[model samples]
Target: MMKKLFLFFKALLTSLLLSACCELNTDNIVYIVSTNDMHANVLNHNKQIDLALISGLKKHYDALLFDAGDAVQGAPLAALSDGDDVISLMNAAGYDAMTLGNHEFDYGQNKLFEHAASANFLTLCSNVYKDKKPLLNNLNLPNEGRYAVFNKNGFKIGVFALTTVQTLQSTDYRLLNTLNFENEVKSAKKMLDLLRPLKLDAIILLAHLGCDDAPCTSKNLALALTGVYQDELDLIIDGHSHQEYVKHVNGITISQTGSRLKQVGLNVLNFKASEKPQVKSILLTYEDLLSKGIKPDAQTEELEQKFRHKQNKILQQEIISLPFTLYGGEQYGIDLSRVTETPAGDLAADAIMYALKTKISSNFLKFPAVAIQNGGNIRVNLGPGAVTYASTLYFEPFLNTLTSKLVSPKILYDIFEHSYRYLNNLSAAGTLQNIKDSGGFLQISGLKIILDPNSKPKVKAIFLDGETTALSRYDTKRKIILAGNDFILSGSDGYSILKDIPTLTEFSDEQDALISYLKHLKENDGFTQYLKAQGRISYTQLPKSVSAYVKIRNFHQQNKKLKFHCSVDGEKFLPCFADKNGLLKFELAPGDHILQIAEATQEIYLNTILGIGIKQGSNLSTIPAVELMPTKE
Candidate 1:
């Protein structure tokens, strides 16, 4: 009996040991480290995360490193080397893969392909195409592909990338006319169809679709696909809007690290045999890594020091001295260029005007000329004294050349309206509300204007350079030469109307123009003229009155009794009628107004239009026709 009992106990112990060993063999863990919108900040600044830190973290965790995009452009180092410097740092830090950001095209398509060829790691973007062929295939680059399969710890992970469609409007439109950016959702679906057949262990998406007001956001993409491919998609790494967040939607995880190396994203995926896999995302700051005793990788740190030494040699040289500081983002402790005019913006506009005044044609020189700079392009502040090339580069980094076009006063008014379209209104307590800042804000030279937010025409009055009378009274039909950077004049930043306008001339880049302007200032001793705001742009307390015209269209031509009514400043609807040609003319007060058309017997309103700007004492014959449809019973 003792021998039988011993045999049974031995068998049970052996069985338990075998089961434990099998469980250990099946369990697996994989780590993914991601960075996005680094903007060529390879070295740490203000304790922000840098490439050295990213490399160290990758080594500490034994993880795969990836960037979401916008890594190659923005700072002086990247601009000087045409993005080769940043690419070298990335290669040393051991990047596994990266998608394309809109700024990748800032240097043009040829240079973009060169960067892709030079990169050791995979550069994957599934949507961008030229001549109906994938960009990677067209370039014939072996290192660049639409999707790549990575093997980590015996697990096969498939990854693909999608570039934002906004690339058309965000980058140089003139240079990219042949390239086509496929729709994000459609391209994602096609990628899934291709990747799913491989039967990989996991599928990941590296997307530049931001989670902002733009269409085709990361959240929207996940929501659209998760309904059909819920079990297939594991994770989405996002960028482009510069937001930092990690949230799960429809059983899929999405993560993004904010711009300028503000944070690093870590995704951990655990897989077990005969069970569903689990993934969790965490955003780590530089402080977070320090508390955990992580150190920068020695090799990457050395490379960063080398690049810093090179940049400092050129950046430290003084160009000009200023008596007072010129501000772009410093006035409100944030970037207020898109919401209001700044001294830095004014300086940039004036510099462009100065550069083009001599280069333009003689016929255009005779007319009134003005320069406008987009708020997005005015990046940094100028110094109170000893402004260096570094400060100038930081102020305007994109190398955009000067462009000019002849435009009439009507087109000028349209431009002004578009600039203020994104302007936020005041709250009931008389405080300015949070503004949805646009890159299209026009910072001008050679003009002064009054704006009222509550009125249909926000621009109350416009005064030309050195003229006390408004431009409307002083030759409203006269043509003016409009000069600005090619980025804006090429129809970027919501200036679509400028796309078809023929270019009058092209001159030197923005940095050169500003440098020449500064040298002139030094020679002429004109620093005091730009010490503060020049009173070019100001907001008014009360709205201005104007003669407005509306073309009422009645689709039902048989209904002659249909009457039109107008409401000024949200008051009661007053009787309004249209002429035989459907043109309704009226005078508006200095406030918000509404125009409505309805059938009087049924009191059924057919259409209501609000905030249409019609200039006073101008030609009403040019007003565009508006068509309205009658409400069905």
Candidate 2:
């Protein structure tokens, strides 16, 4: 009888213990959903996951939502509304907090403050300051602070934000001259010192610093704080490089979701009463959610559609017609604008020159006014037909004003050299990471050059606007005025050589300039001239009598037959075929020879222009295989 009583008590005790443990587990877990570098892609279109889906996830998981910045100023919606539409959507999506990205300041300081005032959540920025005070405080945003503490699931969570110091060079310096960005690591330590006193359960550093090459990056920040204040920082949500990663440095977690709503990040924290909390990071794509039977929130989707409908009325207005498409980088399966010259780039540069010529009738025009548009500024291709204001806005959306300066020929040489520096170090077998294109690559109007990538100085020769003769690198007789956007003229994108040069004239923004130029082309029937690349830039000086091998890979399995053409030493085009192993072998003469490969198949798109240099006896057998895209038909 006594043994039976004892067994009954033991069973009851076991049930009680399990119940307590389950309650503790339920109260201790916290969920955080994050996104970075969204770049104003609030809708679910063009392979981009929607902000409404993010809202659905947040509600379903009972999670906190935060953006790592660059949330504004890329699409026509943001450009037309100066980012108000994005903020409105973010507010509707239930953002808990966000940090400032470099592009956040694209519209200027007053607009930034206006955004902060309109935000339903906190705008946390610990690094940026002006006149020895936080920028928010200085700008009279007393309600928004550098750091905020939240009580979630019975635990106090501390969150602080940091913006990259590179913002000075990435943004208009004039707009940010008064502001100072603190060193990321130093600011992190300061934030830790302040947050630790409050005895928080977890601390997060929300940063716009990327994980790329760095004096300032989230990875560096993690490494820097690993030993000294390792226990102080629990997690870091990073942005600005448009890379996706979730890694641990020491005991702290660093996570980022790539740009344009490609993926949404989740950090799950499990806390206990006395021990260190455990953290786990995860990234989810739209497909992942769909497979799990998750649907976008109805309210958020309705709100997004309302905004879309309002914007489409203004954005759908037609601007001009085109005979053929102008190609930008990536859309045509090649990095045309950044690595080589494209017709779209040429048009952007010409627009600047045309705007300047029409705006100012000074001697600057007489002295060879050449315009150079940074390839990065030309965001998209124009059109094949019926281009709209929305399309043009997407093509150049930063809203940078036009500026011109008279610079020396030496400075001009430096500009061209700087543009080609990224290409000069490329290897025959370099991967995409190694062959990364520079944003500063110049797309020119009224200039031509022969670029020898393998030589000491990449700019082999430069020609004045209409002059057939090449200008000597040391020539000083002819004066030249350089016209471009304020971003490049003010020394952004490493064009410091052009900085501090007195401005000869200032014109309208880039989009306006492009519109005016397109209208002029329409009136003059010059659209046909822009249908193909103008050969404003050419590659030359390849090794003579050297053999090279080119390999091609077909991306589309539907296309079986393909034809190829080869131009050797800039000679007449000749038919070529790859061997059974799919290798095109080339033997060239010793002089400055140019070898080019063109596709003759209508079913496939040529993705790369393989320009290689080889030694006398060496064959470039290790060159990376080029990709070929097949048409849907």
> Which candidate gets the maximum TM-score versus the true structure?
2
- Which portions of model 2 show Cα errors greater than 4 Å? 1-26, 138-144, 226-228, 272-274, 318-345, 349-387, 393-447, 450-535, 538-633
**Residue-by-residue lDDT tens digits, candidate 2, 1-633:** 999999788656545532432222346888888999887878887655898899988886778898899888666678668899899989988999999998788788999989988999888899898888898885444334789888887888889999988776455555675899999889898888887778898898889987763358888888888555877788899897667888998778889998778888878777864456777787777765565456788888998899889889878888788855676645434456787777788889999888777755454357777899998877777776789888887888666667777887778888999997876643333211245577888999988988767677989898886788887788655678888987788788999887766555555457667887998998999886665567788767433244555556662342544456776533577887776656666664322223456562221112233333332244543443565545566
Over 4 Å off in model 1, which ranges? Answer: 1-27, 138-144, 226-228, 273-276, 317-345, 349-387, 393-447, 450-633
In candidate 2, position 52 carries an lDDT of 88
Highest lDDT among the candidates is held by which one?
Answer: 2
